[model samples]
Target: MTESTIITDNFLLSNKKAVLLYHEYAKHLPVIDFHNHLSPLQIAEDKKFDNLTDIWLKGDHYKWRAMRALGVDERFITGQASDEEKFKAWAEVVPATLRNPLFHWTHMELKNPFGINSYLNKDSADRIYLQANERLAQDEFSARSLLKNFKVEMLSTTDDPCDDLTHHQQLIKEGYEIKVKPSFRPDKVFMIGEPVTFKAYLKVLGQKAGVEITTIASLLEALKNRVDFFALQQCSISDHGLSTLPTHFTLSLAQEQEFKTFLKSDQAVFSDPDAFAGFILTELCKMYHERNWVQQFHVGAIRNNNPRMLHKLGPDTGFDSIGDYKHAENLTAFLSHLNLTDQLAQTVVYNLNPADNEVIATMLGNFADGRIKGKMQFGSGWWFLDQKDGIEKQLNALSNMGVVSTFIGMLTDSRSFLSYSRHEYFRRIMCNLFGSEMEAGLLPDDEKWVGEMIQNICYYNAKNYFGLNRG
Candidate 1:
């Protein structure tokens, strides 16, 4: 009815049943963001922003990509421009991003935290900026405060194998109310594509794990040590970023020895890189299962396309795109490899390419070992596929292929503090999908049962599945 209520009570719920289901059951649930790339240091430090630009535009490649598409200058997009200039640049691009998810996400972030109700454009930008900045300057608008406003009961920020998790420890020392835990992300460790970096990464891992990795077996031991260390910090999950699953292969000891020597050399080891990645990943997963940690695989992202920008700006500055890699056979083989030894942990599979939605949806069932409820989950739409269409497609595929009732749903997978509003957006969509089905008589007209399903998908499922305060 008004700017204050633009994304109000009935934002995405198209029918009476959906609205009733949402406000009654789903809207009040706390968020369980089990997978994300949020900075643990920011949460630990509880940093406050000086202006809208620092929190909104800086380090947000989603905005960077949109601004680039609108022909904004590199100086404003990612260069030495002032915060005011960068905000102005983003303001200019917001109007042009009419149908993009950026448009909705921009508004939700604004409305939820800053209470700003104006559409962002050249005309409204300065007013919105000053008002939002005024709110951010308050004591209640700090990073942790923002998360508190969104009711984030628990979150897991991504971390490297070599990290000491000092910030996670700090959160515990301060007794922060919301649970901020680490998810073990060892992409760099499994990444042997950059042979030079692989050797360098191994040295760092050795120092952290207190073991010199001179052989394949020794490397596995080093990683297992880190997993043990991470477990001590209450880490309950592991995430991998892969272009596709490695082709199932294991090297002989003589070949493994040769590969270990090759890691010490300056030359790239193209000699069965798949086997190398597969070996390291399989071994790590065994440790993961032993620790009873959930494993997540984010597959089908083709990252760092522009070497020119990559050199100047570095990775995750929006040079990435969806990869077209075939995932079915290799993915099956990879999961099967872990399962054959009874070592497959609770896994959530995320696909960036929508074409693989059904392929992944069905593949999840093959590894259901009856060890845990929803032991194998088709993860929420990730990265490039986190929009409304992509989100719906993932829900549809999972509902058709698996038991959607037990499905753990909706993670930001984002680096922004303001991104928690995404859970609200996702809950709205989930309600609308279920609501539409009920309105059409596809699902039973039981409000209590269906409403609880909405709650479980929004919060309880992830909270219970991840074993956070589950009593």
Candidate 2:
């Protein structure tokens, strides 16, 4: 495709009404990236990339997975290849990613910050590389500057409980324009199976929280301490990444003693990992409720499938896939356990498996106790489900089973700075969905009414839901 034709102003807007909704309503809205994997240190330092690959390719498993699929060597994907070579390797695979979201995302990223609209391929790779590098050399392409260019009003970076959050503190001290808050993610606290790792993690977490974690009560105290510390940093969100919600929600007295024994002994193995995790998770949710924090659960990912590659490249190196874990029963038990106690915080549940779309969507209604609009949210399509088909299916399921208007929308869930284009991509797709229905007269012909709802889904809903407007 030519430069002009590749990504036009109306790209993805299927009809005139779609075009109007996108251009007039959704196009210029500032992004509230409530959840992402962006590096806080990079933002705090306002780091500038030496080249496109330095910023774009490094730590991007999505591109690495695509590169691996095309038989690109590991050296180019994640190994010690030169940045230029990696960029070329990625460019060579871009054309092959035709129907993939990467095709659109790669071009959209190139079009936006770099302003390179030409399609990336082997022939054009060198030219695009030089052009993009020229821009990267400029001060405008720095990490913080790029966020400004994307009009990101606020973003929450996923952080570990043991982290000191010095970068987040630095950003605050400097009075950065964008709101960069940390979300407490204590997934490691649930890694009871890896006894040595779990014990070591507890040591660090205890030191960080100024508590000695020996029993279940101590563990909860330490976690609560970190939650309080994160709250001091303006953190109102906590996240958990699990294969599925634990089937067991409470610990029996015997099991609780077993956990205590296991924590003390080096060789004592905890018998029921699920019950132990559930006990801690249940307590954490209650703490989140006490602090009025939003809790996010990202479930149904079977990670590190390729053990050989995992051993070679470490985790988050494109070795995870969607899992088919039974979510409904455990999810219901977990949520109900909290709801019964009135401890259910504002929750967003994300399922990686597409099969669970309706499962999650409908589950949102089970406990949305009329106090909050979209209190229980079926989170936007994530991980393996962040593309077009997955996004549409998620939207369709939420619309069919729950209220779509109050839905807080898309997040990058990405490690790359360039991934902000995903918000624009989502806006166009969302506007098209609403605009097409407007044309068909499915609801109403009033653009003002419909456009306001479109704007809510795109921006306002999340702003209100997350209480970002208050600050």
TM-score against truth, every candidate: 0.97, 0.98
Q: What would the per-residue lDDT of candidate 1 be over residues 237-301, giving only the tens digit for each residue?
A: 99999999898568877778787678766666657778888888988888999988999999999
Candidate 2, poorest ten consecutive residues by summed lDDT: 1-10
Please provide, for model 2 over 159-250, each residue's C-alpha lDDT reduced to its tens digit, 9 standing for 90 to 100: 99998999999989889889999999999999999999999999999999999987888888999899999999999999999999997877
| Candidate number of the best lDDT | 2
Clashing pairs for model 2 are: none
C-alpha lDDT of residue 2 in model 1: 25
Give lDDT: candidate 1, residue 37.
82
TM-score of the candidate numbered 1? Answer: 0.97
Model 1: lowest-lDDT 10 consecutive positions: 1-10
The CA lDDT of each predicted structure is 0.88, 0.91
lDDT of 1: 0.88
